[model samples]
Target: MAAPIFSLAFALLLRLTYATAQVDPALISRACEYAKGGPTCVAWLQDNEDDAELSGIDRSDPDSIAFFSLKKIEKEAVTVSEAVSAKLSAGTTEDLSPATQQGLAECKDHYVPAVDLIKEGVDSLAGKAYPDAMKFLRTSTLDLIACQKSLAKLRTDKKDTEADVHATDAINRRDLLASHVALAQSILEFAASGGGAAAASVAAPPS
Candidate 1:
């Protein structure tokens, strides 16, 4: 009886191990192939494997991975918005020109709304409302574009190299946000087209 029980326990353990295994690298590669960021998308997802929200997901499913990516985009938007706010606050003591200050303020305005749109997108995705999710995600990019334009105006009217530097830094952050959004959109497209539909049935949103 002891031998039989021990064998059954070991079998159960094996099943559990397989059930919770890491996401398949090939699946990630295939899904990321359609992303605008391609290799960068793959690396980003892999690098964020330990993220609190991502760590609990069904990594084997492309849909779950795609959902995770959207959550990441929302977080990034919030982070960028906060950083821009901080920069604007520091302008008083940072030797920033009026034009540079205005540009940073505009970027903050755009990013602040973008964070809300991204949150809505994540909620839509969690509910399996694909069209709504896509709509929100796409709309969020409008703010990013607006922010980029603000930075561009700063660069065009830059008073000094310092203003240029500030514009460049903001642009880099905005570009990263855009890339993540594109990657998330691509992953959603893949999932909706038969790559995986597990997200449609997921019981809870990422924490």
Candidate 2:
């Protein structure tokens, strides 16, 4: 009798758990919208990763996966910085084309928060809280992925309306940046989920 009762309770709990679990696949959508399709962060990552794989540029050198990931995050960061610089250079913060303006804003608000989370995750990993660190990186990765998909949509929407080759190049660049950011974000998430280190090896102890 007791065994039957225990089984019933277990089944009931499982049902309740499943009923309350809500996964928001669209969470990234909100993040992407916030950044408005900016791609600076993404493009930087791909270029560097390509260099690493093709030319042996190993700034981070975290085992193959971790090393590649660090290189990628650095790339995204550089791209983000460059985008900010471009915006300043253009002097068109408010006057940007609608798509560009939207992407820039999203990056500052939504995508940036994701970047911050990943940074915290990286820091946490160094402090021995692997689980917590992975959480932050994973969250950031999801949001960045959403940001990428949105930027692609934004590019498709704007490509035809570009005024000339120069204008087209600018739009393409933004899309490229977004793509790279998305890829980097995904890579980070993959690392965090696996419980493997994404950081470079520690220094050797003195004898």
Candidate 3:
């Protein structure tokens, strides 16, 4: 009787192991198709598929994966916006010209809509409101561009200064946010084609 019990436990362990190892390849392929960096996306998904945030999600479903990917990108965009805001605020303390200061102010104003738009877009996508999500995503992209233009208008007067460095940093942050926006747009398109979940079961993947 003990032998039979041990045999049953071993069989259950084997089944559990197989289930844990069964990740769908198509989900990785689909994510690569939509993300900006295909190789990076593929590698990231493979490495982070077992993260806590991805727990309970079916690795075989491409739609679930895409929805989680969009939400992750949304969170990343918010971080980038915060970094850009910090850089802009730091620039205000430097010896910037009056015009440059005003431009920085305008840049801050542009970011006001930029930060929350991605979050709204994510929520809209979760609700299956495709049009609204797309609008918010596109508007967020526009806001990033507008922020860059505001920084461009600022005359640094010389290169390698603190203000110039911070402005450049802001531009880099904008570009990062732009990539997230693009990724979000692609995911939204996929979800619109009946990819998003009817209910929010899947959460974000790894960083």
Off-target runs (Cα >4 Å) in candidate 2 are 1-68, 71-75, 84-96, 153-207
- Alpha carbon lDDT of each predicted model: 0.69, 0.43, 0.60
Candidate 2 residue lDDT tens string, 1-207:
445544653453355345432222233222222323335432332334434232343222211233334445645654554554454334242244567556645544555676676556444433434455546655665665554543443332233332233234434554555454454444444334342233332221232
Q: List TM-scores for all candidates, in order.
A: 0.74, 0.40, 0.64
- Show how many residue pairs clash in every candidate, following the order shown: 0, 14, 0
Report the lDDT tens digits of candidate 3 across residue range 38-67. Answer: 876666445543544434333455545554
Better of 1 and 3 by lDDT: 1
Question: Candidate 1: which stretches are off by over 4 Å?
Answer: 1-22, 155-167, 196-207
Return the TM-score for candidate 2, rounded to 2 decimals: 0.40
lDDT of 1: 0.69
Ten-residue stretch with the least lDDT total in model 1:
198-207
TM-score of 3: 0.64
Which pairs clash in the backbone of model 1? none
